[model samples]
Target chain A: MLEINNLHAKIEDKDILKGINLNVKAGEVHAIMGPNGSGKSTLASVIAGREDYEVSEGSILLNNEDLEELAPEERAHKGVFLSFQYPIEIPGVTVTNFIKTAINESRKANGLDELPAKEMLQKIREKAELLDIDRKFLSRSLNEGFSGGEKKRNEIFQMAMLEPKLSILDETDSGLDIDALKVVANGVNKLKSQDNAVVLITHYQRLLEYIVPDYVHVLHDGKIVKSGGKELALELEAKGYDWLK
Target chain B: MELKEKLVASFLAFENKVSVDTDSNVHDIRSNAFDHFEQHGFPSKKDEEWKYTSLKSILKHDYNVFPEGESAIEFATVKKYFLHEIDSYKIVFIDGVYSSFLSETSHDGYDICLLSAALKQPKYKTVVDHFFNTIAAKKSSITSLNTAFSKEGAYIHIPKSTVVPKPIQIIHFSTGNEAELLLQPRNLIVVGENSHVQIIERHQSLSGNVVLTNSVTEIFANKNSIIDYYKIQNDEKSASLIDNTYVQQKQHSHVSVNTFSFGGNLTRNNLEFFQEGEYIDSTLNGISIIGDKQLVDNHTLVMHKHPNCESHELYKGIYFDKSTGVFNGKVIVEKEAQKTNAFQQNNNILIDDGATINAKPQLEIFADDVKCSHGCTIGQLDSDALFYMRSRGIPKKEANGLLLYAFANDALEKIKIPELKTRITKLIAKKLGVDLGFDL
Candidate 1:
């Protein structure tokens, strides 16, 4: 479902991802684990087309379409989603309204009419139930004064709403407590289908216990130094990243 | 001749046109105000308060001091300017003349009428004489200019313990009767003890002609009274407005003034508040969204004179293209005003490289026990927030508009009327050049 060939990316003058390549097919989950400052988040950002990072060399293809020149929103319209580690707090924009706008904007980009209000509400209600979100919480401002767990859960709720083709979870489990991790993992697991893919970028192996990955890749410096399977996560957790370096 | 000299020379003709009794107190007040204007002319950039805003270009127009030939406008042409969804007491003026046909005044248990009638009639003379121009700055040159020509405007008076069911809408329209016109409107509102009132005022020009409005408003909130005043300055690019509003609050009174500036050539708002007794609450909020070569300046002041009084001020500006903005908020807590709590915040966003914002927050606190804080920020929109919204599938333009709307939302949250809030929200969305999909 996604392919990266020699993806050399840099932010300003500093090189982050140097000559890295990865591929993942539909119906599979991939985990990219690295220590602090190992370009794990940079890979996710580059895949999502964040403008701050420049892809100096090579290209990224999603479903055989080059995403080199696509903007973040264009990538989103093409069914790419990035769940941020620290969600932006937009006061005065209710979560439900934000989700509605996002869904409608995506629809509009695809030459479709806006979703009817009734259908939108039903979808929202269903998604809220799936994510265990309160109706009152949906009416509050988007992430304004939200707890860490609530923010991550809200991101998962949005991911469920959009149903994107490729979902990149960048450090989504960092600030979450055990209960929130379970809820977020459960939501992701239920939404997984044969036509979509999930990329989990994390610093620890705790999340893998809940949502097991089909493959595990340890990113060092910028390139992927090691590739293995689910048992590799437990091995790394036991030995720590110092042994990999 | 310079516009100042012409205005100075037109004072006698103005008085002659009004044909005021020479011995009346109103005549004396006008004469004294004219004298002050003649001495100071118009404020220059050399003055500390007028340092950032220049009036040289605006003051050069040969404005018609008094418009000739009465011009009547069809209500349909100007209906959108009013909050037409709800029933309101409207005091409308056209080219400095009271439009009785377009106005809906009242005298039942209260007075919601024109200032001219209150000045001439014997029944309202006492109320007019005591409160008119009492809180307005006597030494301000432009305010004095408005006072000198303050013959017609809105006059509202609520009796003690009376709550006005309907809001009062005071609208001023210019029909472009002259090549260049100058309008001075003076408003006096007195909310009696335990009374409440809400007012919405706007200055609009029908045609693309040069119009300069120098307006003055004085409001008195008696003991335990509440007042909410809204000023909507969304005139044409050829229109310029200088608004001077003064407010006086008695013990336990609450008063708030919200100024929304969306369009105009050059707009200056001078809003001040004076706390006369203890436990007074004052709020000053403003939002300015302008583009092109337009400029909006907001100068606000709050004086805490008695103990335990609280005041809050928040101003937000969104400038696009080559627009420029200025915000000067001053709060003073006197020594006798112990336990005073005052807060001020001014946030601005410059969308273009040519856009500019000058913000100054001045806090003078002589009371050591008081809590007075002020904050000011000027920058472009947060790129991180923008990227986040765009990543959610919203286009860049809509995301920018939404962020700007959210930045200005807190100030709009204080609108007491639902219809008015919706109208202002639509206005903001329109100003931001986005639909926002739904009412905020």
Candidate 2:
């Protein structure tokens, strides 16, 4: 469902993502693990079309469409979603309203009519129930004064609502307690299907136990040095990343 | 002749036209104000308060001090300017002349009528004599200019213990019958003890002619009274306004003034509040969004004369396409005013490189026990926030608009009137060039 060919990206003349290549088919879950400053987040941001990162030489494709020329919003319209590690706090926009706007804007770009208000509410209710989010919480401002777990859960709520073809969870497990992490992982596992893909980008192997991935890739010095199965996560966790270095 | 000299020469003719009784107090006040205007002429950029805002270009117009006559305007033509969605007492003017046909004034338990009537009527003379120009700045040259020609405007009086059922809307529409015109409107509001009132004022030019307005308003909030005043300055690019509003709060009184400046060639708002007794609360909030060389300057001052008083001030500006904005907030805590709490904040977003914002916060606390804090910020929108919103499927333009709206939402949230809030929300959305798709 997603393809990255010799992905070379940099930020402000400093190369962050060296030569790297990865491919994931639909319905498969992939986990990209690395230590600090290992370019795990940069890879996710580059796939989401963050303008700050320059793709020096590489190409990304989603469903056979070249995403190099598309804007972030256009790529989102084409079903690419990035759950930010640190969510922005928009003081005036309620979470429900933000998601509503996002959903309607995507629909508008795809030449679809706005969802009926009743249906939208029903979907919101269902999604909130799925994530165990309070109804009142949906009315509050987007991520303003929200706890870390609440922010991660809200991001998952958005992913569930949009139902994107490819979802990249960039450090969604960090800053979350065990209980909150379980909720987020459970939601992601339930949302997985044959027509979609999930890419987990994390620094630790703790999340791998909850939402197990079909393939594991260790990113080091801006390159994917190793690729293996789910057992490789336990091996790496027990021995630590220093052994690979 | 220069505009100042012409105004000086036209004073005699203006006095003759009004035909004021020279022996009365009103005549004395007008002549004295005229003398002050003549002495100071127009403030130059050399003055510290006027340093950022220059009146040189605006004063060059050879304006007709008084319009020829009442140019009748249809309600259909100017209906959009009013908050027509709800019931309101409207005092509308056309070409500096009161339009009785378009106005709805009341005298039921309270007075909501024209200033001309209040100045001339024997029954209202006592109230008018006591409150008229009592709180306005005596040294402000432009304020004095408005006082010199203060003949007709809105006059509202809420009786003691009475709460006004509807808001009073004072709108001045310049018909542009002359090539260049100048209007001076004087408003007087007196809220009696324990009474409450809400007022909304706007200055609009009907045609694309050069129009300059010098407006002055004086409000008195009696003991335990409450007042909410809103100023809407969204006029044509050929229009400019100089608004001077002074408010006096008695013991236990609460007053708030919200100014929304969206469009104009140049707009300057001088708002001042004076706490006369203890436990007075004053709030000053403003939102200005301008582009294309438009300028909006807000100069505000709050003086705490008694102990246990509080003042809150917030002003936000969004400038784009070479627009200029200025915010100068001054808070003074007198030596006798102990335990005073005063806070001031000004935040600005300049959308273009050419857009400029000059913000200054001046706080003077003579009392040792008082708490005063002030902050100012001027920057562009957060690029990370922009990317965050864009990645959520909202386009870049919409994302920018949303962020700007949120930045200005703090002041907008203070609007008490629901319909007016919705209207202003729509206006801000329109100003930001986004639909927003729903009511904020």
Candidate 3:
């Protein structure tokens, strides 16, 4: 469902993502393991259609629909979701209100009527239970004054509500404790289906044990140097990125 | 008297020729204010308050006293406005004159009347005289301008120890469309000892052309009484006006005023809060959104006359399309007013490069034991917050609108009236080009 051909991008005239290629079909989890400067986050940002990243070359397609020229929100409406490395603190915009807007915008793009408030609240209750997030957090401003783990869990809860076709978890486990990590991983794993895909972008191999990946690719210097099965991630966890380099 | 001759001949001739001429107070104080206005006329650019704005275009017009004509505020408009969100007493005014035909008040344990009629009452003359004596002294030419041309004013008196459940709603409308008109709408509210009441004063103009409105409001909160006044000035874009709000608080009394200046050409607001009693608390809040060449200037003063008084103020503004905005908030604590706590903040987001905001938060504290702070911030939209929302499925326009409304919520949320709250909500939505459904 996702394809990238020789994708090249830059920020401030410096190349970040040098000619790289990757493919992930539906019903699969891919783990892209890279060191600090291997363009792991840059790739995630470019795919999410962040305006600051300049795409110098190549085309990225979701189901063969051109994704580069679309605005960030338009891309998001097309079933693209990104869990930020650092969740933003959006003061005064309540979490429920934010989720409602997101869900309605996506529904409008799909030519569907927005769900009524009562129905939306009911759905939010179920999602919050599955994601292990307190209803109190949802009532406040979006991620305002929240702990790091709560922010990550809230992001996953949002993903569950929107039900995007492709989910990019960029450093979702970076700042989470082991307990919070398990809750977030459980929420993410519950969202897996036959027609959806998940790209787990993480530096540590511990998260891979919780949400096992079907394919593992060693990314170095903006290029995938090696490709293997789940065992490859375990191997790198033991030997580190030095082997790939 | 040559300048007076010019004013009476050219200006009063236009005032006499208006189609709808209402009764005006030709009293000594107003006549003296007019004499003072003849010397200063309108404030010039040399005046610190009028530095960013020029009333030259307004001065050039042969302005007359807009007379009281037929009102367009029928039952349908009131229902459309109040929305029955909360129970409220409605008082309507047209072209600076009271419209008793369209209004009804219970006078339930309260003193409420038109100043024109109240002046005739022997018992209420002392209060009227006190207000007339001190209002212009509370501010600058803006109050002087209002005092100079006040055609009509509203009065309300709540008895001691009573709490009015429903808020008193005042609607000031400029109905006639002859252009080059002037209106001075005045309001005087006195809450007796231990009484509490809320006041909502709304101003609007039916005509799209120019209307020069000089309005003044004097509020007196007696010992242990509380009065909350809100002013919504949605005048015509071409209208030039000066609005002055004066508040006097007694010992342990509470007073607060929130003014929303959303529409005006060259508008100025002067609010003065004098804490005359011990342990009194005062608050002044304002929000102004300006577009085009519109200018909205607000000057506020918080004076702690006695010890243990407190005052807090916050004003936010948004400017676009070369609009100019000014905010000057001053806090003064007397030498004996110990333990005085004063705070002031003024923030503005200039949406366009050409738009400018002159913000100053001043403090003059003579008390040795006092907590006084003031701050000002002028910047554009937060790009970080903008990108964060856009990263979600929210569109750019909707994102910007949400952020803008969030920036305004600090003041808008303070509005206690639900009907007025929702109306202002929809007004900001429309201004941001977003759809909130309940269109104003």
Candidate 4:
């Protein structure tokens, strides 16, 4: 469903992602694991069309369409969703309102009618129940003064709401406790389908235990140095990233 | 002659036409105010208080000091400007003349009538004598100018221990009857001890005519009274307004003033609060959103004369194009006013490179036991917040608008009136020129 061909991207004259290649078919969970400064997040951000990172070479293709020229929002319209490592705190915009705006804006771009309020509320209720988020949490400002675990859970909740074709979870388990990590992973697992794909970018193999990846790729020094089956995650977890370095 | 000289020259003829009891105290007050305005004329930019706001350019117009004739305005034509959501006491004026057809004045229990009626009637003579032009700033030439012509405006007087049944709305509409018009609306509100009142004031120009409003309002909140005052400054681009509002609070009284500036060519607001007793609370809040060459200047002063008094001030501005905004907030705590708590904050966002914001927060505290803090910030939109919103499938323009609305929402949260809050929310959205498909 998504293909990255020798992607070399840089930010402000400094190369971040260099000579990276990855391909994921439908319904596959791909885990990109690496230590800090390994460009794991950069690859995810580039695929999500973050404008700060210029594509010095190669292309990111979704359904054989090159996404180099599309905006971040355009890429989002084309079913690219990036769960930020640190979600932004948008004060005065309620979580429900923010998700509604995102959903309606995407629908508008796709020339679809706005989701009916009743149906939207029903979907929100179902998703919130799945994530175990309180109804009061939906009324508060988006990510303002939220706990770390709550922020990560809210990100996964947005993923559930958007139901994107390809979802990139960038450090989605960074700040989560054991229970929150389980809840987030459970939500992602429930949302998985044969028509969509999931890309997990993390520094640890801890999240891989919950949503087991079909393919594991070790990203090091701006390139995916190794690719293997799910056992590769257990091998890397048992042996530190220093061994690979 | 310039507008200042024309007003000075036309004062006598203007005074002679309106016959008042020469023996009354208001007569002498008017004469003294006229002399004060004549001496200072129009404030120059060199004046410290008027440094950022210059009346020199706006005063160049040939404004008619006395727009004598009344032009009829259909209530349906301008009904949207009113707080049509709820019932209100409306004192509406057209071309400086009271439009009874469009006004809903009250005299049942509390007095919600015209300032002219209060000044002329023997029944309301005591109120007129006690409160008329009493608390206005004498040093402000523009204020003195309003006091000199302080004849027609909304007069609201709530007796002791009474709550006004409905909020009063003072709206002045200029119908473009004259080539250039100058309107002076004088408002006097006296909320007695333990009384509560809310007032909303607005000035609108119906046509693209040069209209300048020099307005003065004096509010006296007696002991244990509560007052909520809102000023909506959204006028035609050809209209300019200089609003001078003075609020005097007694013991245990709370007064909040919220000014929402969304339109107008140039708007200068001089809001002052004077605390006379202990445990008084004064809140000053403002939100300004403007584009083009429009300019808005908000000058505020809170004087803490008694002990155990507190004042809070917050003003936020969002400027686009070449629009300019000025916020000058001053808090003064006297030596005897021990335990005074004063906080002032001014934050601004410049949407365009050409847009400008000059924010100055001044605090003068003589009391040793006082908690006084002031903060000011001038910045552009947060790039990180913008990208975060855009990354969520929202366009850049809508994202910026959403962030801007969020920035201003901190100030908007202080609106006590729900309907007014909704109206101002829509106004902010419209001012940002974005259709976020939802109300902020």
For model 1, which pairs clash? none
List, in order, the clash count of every candidate structure: 0, 0, 0, 0
Candidate 2 structure quality by residue, lDDT tens digits, A165-231: 9999999999999999999999999999999999999988999999999999999999999999999
Candidate 4 on A49-96: residue-level lDDT in tens? 888889999989998999999999999889999999999998888999
Q: Ten consecutive residues with minimal summed lDDT in candidate 3 chain B?
A: B17-26
**Tens-place lDDT digits, model 2, residues B1-440:** 89999999988888888855444588888889999999998999998999999999999999999786978888998999999999999998998899988899999999999888888778887897788888889999889888888898899988899999999999999987888999999999999999999999999998999999999999999999999999999999999999999999999999999999999999999999999999999999999999999999999999999999999999999999999999999999999999999999999998999999989899888999999999899999999999999999999999998999889988999999999998999999999999897656
The list of candidate 3 runs beyond 4 A from truth reads A116-118, A218-228, A231-245, B1-28, B66-73, B77-84, B366-368, B436-440
- Measured against the true structure, the TM-scores of the candidates, in listed sequence, are 0.99, 0.98, 0.91, 0.98
Give fnat for candidate 3: 0.56
Each prediction's RMSD to truth: 1.0, 1.3, 3.8, 1.5
CA lDDT scores, all candidates in order: 0.93, 0.93, 0.80, 0.91
Query: Candidate 3 on B1-440: residue-level lDDT in tens?
Result: 33234454444544344322123233666657656766666567898766766777776766655464555556665454442577777677777767786555656677666766666556666677666547445236556656655546777878889998888888776765556667777777888899999888777777686687777888888999988888877667877778777888899998889888888788888788877879998989898988898899898888887888888798999998899998988888889999998889898999988998988778887889989888899988887677667767888888888888888878887787777777887877877777632122
Q: After superposition on all CA atoms, how large is the RMSD of candidate 4?
A: 1.5
Q: How should the candidates be ordered by TM-score, best one leading?
A: 1, 2, 4, 3
Alpha-carbon runs more than 4 Å astray in model 1? B21-23
Best by TM-score: 1
Ranking by DockQ: 1, 2, 4, 3
For TM-score, candidate 1 versus 2, the one ahead is: 1
Candidate 4 ranges with C-alpha deviation above 4 Å? none
Model 3: DockQ vs. true structure:
0.50
Q: Per-residue alpha-carbon lDDT of model 1 for A22-117, expressed as tens digits?
A: 999999999999899999999998898899999999989999999999999999999999999999999889999999999999999999999999
What is the alpha-carbon interface RMSD for each candidate? Answer: 0.6, 0.7, 2.5, 1.0
Best-fitting candidate, scored by DockQ? 1
Question: DockQ for each of the predicted structures, in order?
Answer: 0.86, 0.83, 0.50, 0.76
